[model samples]
Target: MQSTRQNSQQMDESDFYTNCRAVYLTMFKSSLENITSKEQLCTVLQQAGRNPSQKTLNKYWGPKTSKLNFDDFCEILRKEKPTGRSELMQAFREIDVNGDGFITHSELYKVLTSKGERMTREEVKAIISVADTNSDGKLDYKEFCKLFMSTTEVCQKRALERMEADNKMRRQQFGSHSEGFSKSSLSHTANPSLGTNQQAEMDVTPRKGEGKSSMRPSSARSRRASVSSTISMGASGGSKTGKLLMPKSVQDWHHTALKGCFFLEEDGEISSHQYRLDVPQTSTVFLTIKPMNLSQVEEKPSSWMSVDAMFFIVKDHEDLDDMRVVCFTELREKEKFGWKGELSSGVYYILPFTTGCRLKKKKKNIKEQAQLVCRGEGGKLALTKEFRAALSDIFEVIDLDGNGLLSLEEYNFFEQRTSGEKCDEEAWAVCKENFDTKKNELTRQGFMDLNLMEAIDRNGDPCDLWVTLESMGFNRALEMVEACPFILDAHSEECKLRLKAVNLKQSSKVLDTAICKSVMAKGEAKVMKGSESVTIYTYKNDFRITSVIANKSNQKVTIHVNSEQSKNCLSSRGISMFAVEVPPRSNVVCQHVLPINERQEWIYNCTESLVA
Candidate 1:
């Protein structure tokens, strides 16, 4: 078989070359001896359908302006010829008449038959069956290339060469053993402590109470140095104990706080958010208070001091949490806190007079909480003025009928255009039930009430932009979003609201219940609504029966399966035919399993009596 294939390939190549030489000779009309000058070579090339420039012809003729011989001309033509893949791609595109990224069977058949190739429909189907790896019943670019190039010796040789080069590269990267270099080997190269002698000794001798050593001496030395530095610093600072000193007035307190000193009161309101501190004698402090969790504060509180207005106290401490209370003028400013100016640790109490009315915290209702959780992380939902305005603009655009409402159809079109997929059914159903007050369509008010950003959350946690981007199949867009999160914010004032509205509409469309009936259903089964019971029959010739049962009742419905010719298919699978509960307003697929030759007549009975 191999020898026959090789001979066939050799014959094809020889035939190709023969056709090429015949065409060349016919176009030139003169023998190799006749062409002597650059002008003559240019004339012959131009006659052969290649308009060679004077400079290009000169390069071929050499610095002396000599003419090319017939052998050199043939070699140049061979080198200039397009590769098999390129030619195949061109042919594939030509055959793909509609340019829908695939060549249909009919398209291929028409193209082939028009070119004088005679073949039956079955023969064409057979060829496609071999090439269509994805089983889509069409020839994609890969399938078309494979079908044409697999038979060509040149393509096969090129493929083999690529495979060999890839393998060689893999071996070089992974090494011959394929185990890769150990962490110890990498650390040895990075650290200067691991000299050649120490590395050699470690390789020869295993450490005490160790089966194998993955850590090099250099890594151990580096770790010890770090530990010793930390210990020495602690020893030097720990000897001197400092006392808590209180500031005379709020102005003094503010000055000390600006110098990176914080004071925490025992009974004061402590939260992980921003607050306005209005000291009676000092300027109002607009700062964010970050309270350290117990696990983070290793050192015990040295002393607790009670001050009336505010105070500045210092101690020898490096840990941010050791100060017991830390405050930042801004969120970004918190990153600047470190053991820099003075080794500080202490808590100061402040009782500030109100400059104006304090901001009130509004209690959120359950519905609002659910929406907020969906929109932002950690229940922190604050829509910028620009973002809200953007949403309003989007809502106006989506209201195509201009009745201040978005119908289901309009919503679906918007979703299809934005996310490329329908919104999830369960999510849409929830939105309609909760946000869609009229239950007819999404009104502008209803749309605004929905947390569209949260609706795309797949994991039901806080809204994640990356997850949303990925779900929408915007992978490259997601990378850009990661690099610049503010891009979403920057563009939010324009299309953010529109994007969310589309998301909500998509969610609604995806959840709309539509049943899929068995394709094999003829007249054997009949669907009838009864006051107490519903009965369905399966065809006698049907070896398997599939039916989609939707529960329209307020409560769950259990389906009872019965068969006359065989054991209950549902019962055999350990499912209770009498107690198969279908959730309210949800659809369930009921299928009967039987042997290929076993044609069973079955009946499905559902009634109020079967409700569970």
Candidate 2:
């Protein structure tokens, strides 16, 4: 969205190169120092299978253009190709600020400001402080080059020099100590006569009148003991690995309060560091504690429960005991009561206090919600896209007039179409029969509302002869029917459904033996009868089927069709079921309601004989 501007508008080439060099040398000191020649560095990169550009190599070499001594080295580096003139000019401008063949901090700040970098006065002062080589409040060209380059080089040089000096000192000390020991050993070995005289003299004791000898072994032992004590103290003291070692005073304090012996007087300041409390069920209580930070609670101190309780901080907030205290435990012990329906995540257990306070806790160690649902009784079926498509096909079948949407009548037609079927069909019919009968035809949106509503009005009367799209002064009911398919398709598979079917008692009856087949795909089902003028029925039920019927010639297929409805009975017309080949292993079943007045013998005869 934003265009990148020129080098000067951002960072001048020279300044950028200097900064890159500084960072590179500071981070990769040995590599930068050892690889003196540009060609050698390029050779190294080539050996490593790298091909860094010349510009990148020059940038890592620091701002050498301003330093006359490095000019030849820079030229040698660029022998492969001539460097860009604009970049060299920018480098020159950086060194020769004010166009007076000299550089200064004011000039640098001006250049940075011109490039849209707004460095404050203090920041400018800091930059100047770093760049001031002579410490004379300003910089000349030569001093500027030295200071800029030294930012990276000086720190490394100082550190190396210090290491060299320390090594030299160590060597000198070792040599001198070795020579002193050799001289002492040589004198003892070469003069046994003197050694015996010395031993004899040492064996002699001072006279009783003599003052206390200065070289007493007792004094030497005391001095040696003191030195050993100091070493031990120093070893155990000072910083551990550059961090102040755990202060003994603090550790002792903790040990004394937590594990150290304490005399508990009646009301003395005994460290009440650990305690447990039992809470009653459905009861509220306030706990008081000594005013201290929650972290100081020594009872199960590592549990985050203490931190969770801290959010209720007040002048006198009570400390929580260990997590062992379960509020339900007291209830179970006393009243033999326990909560039904276990707690779930995203649901919190609130423990209310008598002081108008509460604590919230997430349910711990619980099975996931999805797993819980899966383990539910009867084993819930996964509501997948295919299942939803089936429901949409059923919805579209009911929206008869080929309208783009469904009215109450169209929706009811769907319900009625499948109401008389069995299994899921029966379930759907039982659930939605009242829904369909209560309205003429539900609009697509209206059906959605009814589906989402928890309950239906029981007392309302049913509507009859609902207005079609044409009657409603809309486009043809075909558009409405078209719209119904989409809405049904959109229905989540999770939506509970029931499918039902009806059949005649006679096994050989036209509706009994003939099968109606529908093929479903892309959320819509087409019933496949050989002819375009095939007759289908829409009962008050929720069953969906789609098909593509190949013509007798098997050349073309017709997709959508509206079936006719039967009165006071379920019927499928124009049984063009020749399109379907029945599998030998297929099981066929039929269900229908028994007339209330029918004799038990008649009902038995009707179902048993036909089913058989």
Candidate 3:
């Protein structure tokens, strides 16, 4: 077997700190700012893909050498005896790049991903979630320490504490002439030809794909190699170490178009949609249903089916009626209904069905449908370390509750969101039987296992896995090897409905829109206020009830949903109490209010609140 560990040439203190200086000189607002202390330099080194140990970093930028925050920083270092509170308080300030009292998720994510042992995005999110007492997505100094705690127990049992003994010992040693750790290196002869040490090589693997973030310092130099600096920490070499060390995945956006197709059984004409996927190997298949009109004959503007359609990714059979559904999309009002499941290359059918005979959706509403599209991406997300890391991020993204356990209901939401398939009672039971679970909730391991099972069932052909990781909003821009994304528009026997790409769109102010007029036309609204940022719009009718929650803020918001107000109402997930997370300025169908009996007045009085 090949060696799994990666090896790279190591750098000495001069190279390491100079590379650190390279990052500091580049990403900062001004190129002149020097790396005067460990705190400032540590964060920069993270962006540069160098994670030195405490002993190592301290050895390079020691207590005596650092000019941290002038006297304030040095006072703590000099005394080495600041109280635990003071030490942590100081640490928080250094991490706060903009000097903002709170540390934002993006900032924290950047620090964690670049500096430490590679972490799944989920791990970092969990850390802040503990200290984010206000549920505002950012951490204040106190919350930061509380989340970091293990000793004082002032906050929850998870509180972090610095030892009083350690602080006192460091303070008592403020004696002899403590010299700069870098003094020897600084005194060495200066080299004028290294040309700024800009090309220093680190182990970060660079790819042409979308990096984690797109936020680049406009003034930063282009990608170069061999980063080196003189004894003086003047950065000269340019090392563009995958510049996307920031918080966001800017490449995950979609190029969307409005697509239309007819159901298989309409007016007994037997028209259906089928696409061939003759993959030379196993692959991934995912698709989304952002919106579909329920209108027949004349397309009514702004309408969702009275009940959503059943979509399927099925084995393509010569007879449409005999097709075997590989996956199912349950009937629900989920606006972001999609799939990200693995598939072997073969012909398949993308089937959509409702109970109605013949139905027609006008082109007028097609643009609106396309504009409200669930995002589609992940053309090649193979199961590499990157894929594993991506899955960890996905797990955290779906873990609406910070409890670290994925309740069956939460897992169900994940299922429906990723594959439009609900994790029914039997499926949930099977999960508990096979994978790790806690208190009937899927642990992070189980969540991973569930996804792993999909690919594993196919004997682990990773081409499929790559496609599976490509997009969270699984929808129909699917393709095979060397295939460009296209939509097949066809007309059956005698149906007059036409299919065309009505428009091309990017973003939608979908959440900004007021109560969907179509939703109002079908049922009465049940208003549930979670926060100023999130609004849960519930609509009730005879058979079932549905709710859509929208976030108005720039931060990802989690709102707990409670159906207790409805004496006998249960959500489609079968749980009356599960939280839903709404991304910033986005809306999703959060709940499907199912009724125990069809004859009763389906009282869907659901309530919600921001998770704090």
Query: TM-score for all predictions?
Result: 0.17, 0.16, 0.23
Would you list the C-alpha lDDT of every candidate in the order shown? 0.33, 0.25, 0.40
Candidate with maximal TM-score: 3
Q: Write the per-residue lDDT of candidate 2 for residues 416-469, one digit (tens) a residue.
A: 322323334454455455443333344444443343232123222111112122
Cα lDDT, model 1, residue 556 = 33
Which RMSD does model 3 reach against the true structure?
29.2
Error of 1 at 435 (Å): 1.0
* Model 3 regions more than 4 Å off: 1-156, 159-495, 498-517, 520-534, 553-556, 565-568, 599-601
The lowest-lDDT stretch of 10 consecutive residues in candidate 1 is 198-207
lDDT of 3 at 169: 42
Look at candidate 3 and tell me the lDDT of residue 438: 85
Cα shift from native, residue 135, model 2 (Å) = 12
Query: Candidate 2 regions off by >4 Å?
Result: 1-89, 92-98, 103-107, 113-120, 126-143, 146-156, 172-612
lDDT of 1 by residue, 288-368 (tens): 212121121456521111111111111211232232222211111111111111212222222111100011111223332
Candidate 3's residue-wise lDDT over 1-612, tens digit each? 123221121223223322333333334432223356677756554444344457656754643343332112221232332136667778678889888688887887887788746667888878777777788878786666654443333321211112223222432331111222223422111111101111111111111122243232211111221111111111111212211121133133222222333321111111222233333345433344433332235745223333233344446444433445565433222332344456564555444432221122111212221111111264432234434455664565445444678876556554543344677888778879999988888888776666666665665554444444332322222211110111222211212222222211111121112112223334343322212334445454333355565444444444545454464444544444444445545555554554444334345555455432
Worst 10 residues of 2 by lDDT: 194-203
Q: All predictions: root-mean-square deviation over Cα? A: 33.5, 42.4, 29.2
* Count of residue pairs whose backbone atoms collide, per candidate: 4, 56, 26
